[model samples]
Target: MNDSDAINKYHLSVERADGQTDNLVVSEGHQQPEDVASTRLERVNLRNGGNVDYQEFALEQEMILKARGASKILQVCVMLPLEGAYSMITPEGEECHFTPNQGFMFRYIGEEVTFTLPGHQTVRSLGFCVSLDVFKRYLDNQIPDTIKPMLQPKEIGSLPVPFQIDNFMRETLDRNLQVEAQGSLKQIRWEGTALLCMALVEEKLHKAANPETFSLTQACKQKAEAALELLMADMQDPPCLADLAQELSITEKKLNLIFKSLYGDTVFEYLRSIRLNKAKNLIEQTNMAMKEIAWTVGYNHSTNFSKAFTRQFNITPANFAKKARKLTKVS
Candidate 1:
């Protein structure tokens, strides 16, 4: 069979965008509903190639593949690790391990593989079946044919990415699933899928250049994360840049750069945004007067609060509060 036909015969197709197509099929061994659901769970012993077992435990998992049959295109499998490791055999026949904070992807055609799980691991995984046509459309517009091969099943296999990507994915999915606003859910879902695709492409490219750079040191990452947590703990009494730098035991300039690098905003800007958001929440959810809500969020002057709120939300505080109340009453 031709390569295209070979891909079609094996994996299911799922839609990635409005006009784009991609196909994904779980290994036939994973076709059973119970089996699929079992894989969705976080902690499972997965044996991929040899007799040696790899225990896979994730906080959450999601898979998106194109539709199945003649129209199939791309397949995406996401396994989010919560607190354990899983083993898999790479396309190069190398045995590799993945931690709970890591993920892997497999792209292939006519390749048979098995994922075995022990009965004790309890984890959640999400699977997406997408269509190839969607990916073709995306490729036609955004990807070149030379790179197109890279996106094909066999060309790219088992790319690993950071756990932050999984958190973003889960947040996007949960938001899309719970959103009740008209047209918002689909918009978010589509955006989420696009982000997932972009992440996959980035992983492939990164690995091609440097295969050894995927893992993050848990201790260092935790230290950076803890510093961020401390900075965010008190929005109203937000720390000055100097104070924050001292708390984190870094120079002020270094702290500013790090905050910007990690969060795409300066510490002061991030804190201001947080305070504004809190003010907004108070306005919408509580019976506090506008001035009191403003004070609660570190804004002492109602006028200054109104100006900041207007700049941030594109509406005056009073107006926003009024609209929120109206919407709540209508609901």
Candidate 2:
């Protein structure tokens, strides 16, 4: 169909919970429609007012997207809650599943194929589409050819981002949408696109099925150590594995493995040790109440903290504090 005909055939609009209004214009037959697609390539703030519920599917359908035959490269940014299972089979026959708290990427080369969103499960997601040519110009050959395949016929899933990164990306997208209403910033848009692509490629490369993984390398170990130190450095807000994993750009499973191999304890156990050690120092130096000390050591309930303390130090927190006081007084 001609551009005018294609435009007439397809109805492109900005849809929100309250209503739908015309925002995006794609001439029908200009491109094959995507199974699920969203973007604000022209207007930035186009996504500022849309709410889509958790989608669940018992069965999957074929997913395909045909962009207008324009030789423009497209970058699609998607954000979804990591709480359910999602799988994608690439045109090349590679199939994979991503568990909760993870995200993946898929690239297309204007081919038509079946894209499926399984039923009976719910996830909240936001997808941003960009022209591929724009992306190529932005990276200027810094993007590896090996990585270029990611932009076409590839499936990425089950990778988690640090909460900070997740929040940053979400906020950036939101802000871009808002700014787009005022005007489009091509540089800023390109930067956002680049960041998303870098994150996707970095996550994939780190988690590749190889023995010499990124997290296992010495440099990565040092980086992890620095991150762990920062996390424990603030005893008041001790970090959780999930939070730390996001910051480190590795999965919780891999973090556990690395911590066990290097520190001889899982991340949880290590935090407990830190808390216990702090409690011991407090017991020796101060005549604080057990409950008070427990609170100071990152525990809300004294009873549970005391049990954990005893398990680690071979004595109740109260008794340890008493003995510690006596030792200090005598000394």
Residue-level lDDT tens digits of model 1 in 1-331: 5534433234443222233433344332223323233332111111221010111222123322322233223443334433333454544465444443344443433343333222223332333322344444544556532244435554565343233333344445435434443355544444454445445544544544543322334543454576668756765576676776677676676554555556655566666678889888887788799888888878778887775675455456777788898888898
lDDT of 2 by residue, 42-116 (tens): 222222211111122211222222222222123333334322344544445555444332455445332322233
lDDT score for residue 44 of model 1: 17
lDDT of each: 0.46, 0.47
Sum up the clashes in candidate 2: 31
Q: TM-score of predicted model 1? A: 0.36
Cα lDDT, model 2, residue 279: 88
Point out where model 2 deviates above 4 Å.
1-83, 91-93, 112-121, 128-132, 145-257, 260-331
How many steric clashes between backbone atoms does each model show? 65, 31
